[model samples]
Target: MTVDKESDKGPYICNGTQSSDPEYTQSSDEVTLTVAEKPEPELTSDLKGAALTGNSVTLYCTLKLQSAGWKFYWSKDTQSRETETETNHYFIRSVSVSDEGQYRCRAGRGNPVYYTHYSDALWVTVSGESPPVSLIINPSRSQHFTADSLSLSCEEQRDSTGWTVKRYTL
Candidate 1:
């Protein structure tokens, strides 16, 4: 019997009776069946934002409760790309603009092949140019007095909304 809903989970018992001169009955131990909804695998990438062209990136597909005998499947832009793959990590040796797309993954295991829901899409963008960032100091000069006031700013060739400034001093 195939169970597909939570409401079907409960305890079950089998009873048997025999008819003769004296009626006899026997009862077996109760057996409980538990059912749970299939979980969706989580998809993640090493690159936090746009990936530079010719750079390598790795995508990982994982489940909360990991088990053995799972085969992973990867898709790009809703198109089936990999099927029945043994590894959970998808490695891209080199990425290009043509590789940019919405990627997703799913896992399947066990006999009769039970499959989990597809993971959330991870959008990958490939940039041809490398991100350029420079630091600008106001009152441009080689020497600065002890109390001299100076302004430090960060400039980027592209968008600087998410850029961070860091400095190391002895």
Candidate 2:
């Protein structure tokens, strides 16, 4: 039997009677049937189109009701990516060629483990080429005095932002 809607849930009891003795009748105990709604997770990407190498991207998985005790799962190319996490969002700090694949996500809750339907696949493509970058140092010189004032900046040919300068000192 199929339950079409939530209103179909209710208590049901069966009654039986003996054909030989029309007056004889028996009633079964009442039983209530419960219907739990299945969750369908929604998957979305922060950036559209193909992502460039060295860029960052984030994927979001969410439910309509937003209940508690939900843990999100992420996968790429049908293979599990990260361990279960409480947060609904998955972040990739620096995208690489290996990161390109069909991504999907799902959510689960409860002890017995009730899982929502996997969200639609989100295709992620990574460009093998990185934007051209040039480093410029003020007072252009190969060597500088310890007390000399110096400045460094990174310039990218593309309009992309979020670049930072890092240095290692001994």
Candidate 3:
């Protein structure tokens, strides 16, 4: 490495050329660059939908590898990336069928950035009827103690043909 001064007006300039990096052999002055493979982000969601209309869903993107400082970009159904988030979580406030699509994400960091490959696609679907639905849980609530056994049913106000009572505990 060498430092040169053209004049006193210049702040010190690094006139250094060449690198000690063992990754490449600079042949005939044509510098070839190699990029590492992109990491795949893991996608997870709160509800594995067919979720109800008014509920919100948050999708989380995680890197399986031990790397840091990543910004995420998300894509749905197409290759075009949308929604650049510094954090790994993508939040959808209220979902409709229009929001139903396959989603993927990638992670990138650094100035001349290296990006991980797109993650495995996650599918989200929204289900609703023409008149919509209002669900009621039986035995009107006030606050109850934990571990008390409660048998609740999601009584849909309008539809009976395609209704099921399902409960999930986390």
RMSD of each: 9.2, 9.1, 11.7
Report the C-alpha lDDT of model 3 over 75-160, residue by residue, as the tens digit: 89975757899899998888777888898888889989868888889998888743333445545587667886666555456656
lDDT of 2: 0.84
Poorly placed runs, candidate 3 (over 4 Å): 1-37, 129-170
lDDT of 2 at 8: 75
TM-score against native, each model: 0.63, 0.61, 0.55
* Top TM-score prediction, candidate number: 1
Tens-digit lDDT track of model 1 for 13-80: 88788867336778899999988888789999999788898789899999887778899999999985
lDDT of each: 0.84, 0.84, 0.72
List of clashing residue pairs for candidate 2: none
Residue 1 error, candidate 1, Å: 4.0
For model 3 the local lDDT of residue 28 reads 49
